[model samples]
Target: MKTARRYLASEIYRTTIAVILVLLGLFIFFDMIDALDNLNEKFTFVSLLYVQALQIPNRLYDLLPICVLIGTVIALAGLAQRNELVILRVSGISSKRLLWMLWLITIPFMIFAAFVSEVVTPYTEKKTSEFTISALGKNSTKMDSGYWFREPVDDAHYRVINIRRLNSSTEIDTITIFEYNTQDNQLSSVTNAAKGILQHGELRLDNVTTRTLTSNLAQVLTNEQAPLESISSLKTQKTISFKTSLTSERLVATELQPDKMSTPDLLNYVQYLEENNLQANRHIVALWRKGSYPFTLLVMITLAAPIGFVQSRKGGVGAKIFLGILIGIIFFMANQLALNVGMLNNLPPWLTALLPNIIALILAFGALYLMERRSKPRNFIHAK
Candidate 1:
């Protein structure tokens, strides 16, 4: 059994690697074409190629499970085609043991995936973002204060502006807010002399003037701005100011971009997102989706083992491989759909992420079980 297991494992590993290379080639070919249009100016061929290469790892990270499934299915199918599985079956190789061996193959892949996401993805994404900005000749794109984001809010659009500044110690100093109306899409109200300071475990923005047009006849009914001193009497607060010498790690929480965050950071951010009435389900789902990868490879192996061994199955090898691809595509779609729906409907974060895996596992297990039952010999009796 040990010898047989090693042989099968070696074959499965080789086949899986081959499939990964083919998939990676396809991804690179398309990505290079996409990168070509941006090859001029800041996006040079070298930078573009490097960026694309950096991007491939993340893409591979995302595509790992499917790749595993395809490779496993193909490998198993080949063995079945050559009647090798039947020979192995006659040598005391039970379906359960085969499943266990497949699971073992996934363990290493899962560890590799965890390392990739934890150490590699964040670094690469940061590099990619920086490359994009540097290529465009922008010093800094982060709009802290004196920043404005315009978007449609309710019946009208507003250009929300912040006149924000940080002290030498990297603390929020003075913040000014401005709101522009979209009815005429003109600057209607300017709320200035505002500030953001740390207060009672929360980042508080003071001197706020929630202003708007009261009538369609070009009139401002309300424009209010209060000073920090006015709100100072409300509580005991430590004056916080921004310092210019702060690093990214010190000023911003890593959880802001959960995908770029490490596992621990992602988990923490998910908690923060949940408490803040934000859509954490999607981010949490992504984290889960990433985390589940190595296990997924094992699942693919388990799934492939039975399908590959079924000599009397109706489908041809191409058809079987096509079926595997379809399954992969469906899993991807279902995972994405669950994320969107869970975010929109406020479902539990973990459940949204686990939905696809759970479904796929059930299908794979059931198929494997049925195949095993059929493969059992007619003269065999229950040992119990």
Candidate 2:
């Protein structure tokens, strides 16, 4: 029994790693090619490699489900083909015991995945975005108040927008902007808005006050290239709309793509949106979806056991493997489709996140029960 359990664990581990590595290598090759095609002024070969390296965790997080499904099915099918499972069964290892071993094999991976998604993936994603944004030619200025980044309009003008907290697509909170004269290297003026929003591809500021700093603007123009204007001393809001290349859709995508955020960050952002009276259904769904990853992996273990061994009554190994692949595709699509539906229809987030896993488990247990019932009875009278 001990040897059998060890064999089972080793086989599953080896197969899972092999599948993951193959998938990652293929993905990395394509991604690197795409990056090389999009190469710009800021990204060197080394920097591009670093960016792609940071992307691996996210890719792994996305691919883990199918890997688990395929790996477990193939591992078990290998054992069955070699007749090792038949030997174990003759040695009085019941179907329940085999299922238990499968679950046990998946436990360590479940723990590892929980830590990766909650910590490693989020951290790496932040780094990836920071590098990408820096490559896009933006600079940040720190102030006593929250800092803003400079988005260049052209050679002689740029927009300095400070965002304290992003509320939602509808409203951005505590945003302040200082439009600067780049050629003169002087402060044009200062505008502070409690909330700024997008309306028809234009920015509208709310609770605004404007301060005209043109009086001392000459004193601040000390350098042509070093154009860091101090706007914290100005306590005023201004209605200044210098049409930036950043649209509402782009702004939201940069800051609020929940896939790139940690679970807690997504939750806080969702609450911030709700407080400011904005729609956060999609963010809510993303939060729970990230939180469900480990649980989904565990559910996949239960799912693999029945399906992997179901071929004892069916055709060949290829047939069973093909069936497993089909089931995995269906499960993945169903789960993704549920999340999309929830986001679009404003359905409950947690329910949508969990529906596919729940369905998979129920089907697994049902199949396991049927497999047990149809198997040869354990009791047999010895005739001497």
lDDT winner: 2
Per-prediction tally of clashes = 13, 5
In model 2, what lDDT does residue 25 have?
93
Q: Across residues 49-124, which tens digit of lDDT does each residue of candidate 2 receive?
A: 8988998988898888888888888898888877778788879998899988887888888888887888888788
**What lDDT score belongs to each candidate, Candidate 1 first?**
0.62, 0.74
Off by over 4 Å in 2: 138-256, 311-315, 377-384
Q: Which pairs of residues collide in model 2?
A: 191-238, 192-237, 209-237, 209-238, 210-237
Query: TM-scores for all candidates?
Result: 0.70, 0.69
**How much is the lDDT of residue 286 in candidate 1?**
63
Error of 1 at 42 (Å): 1.6
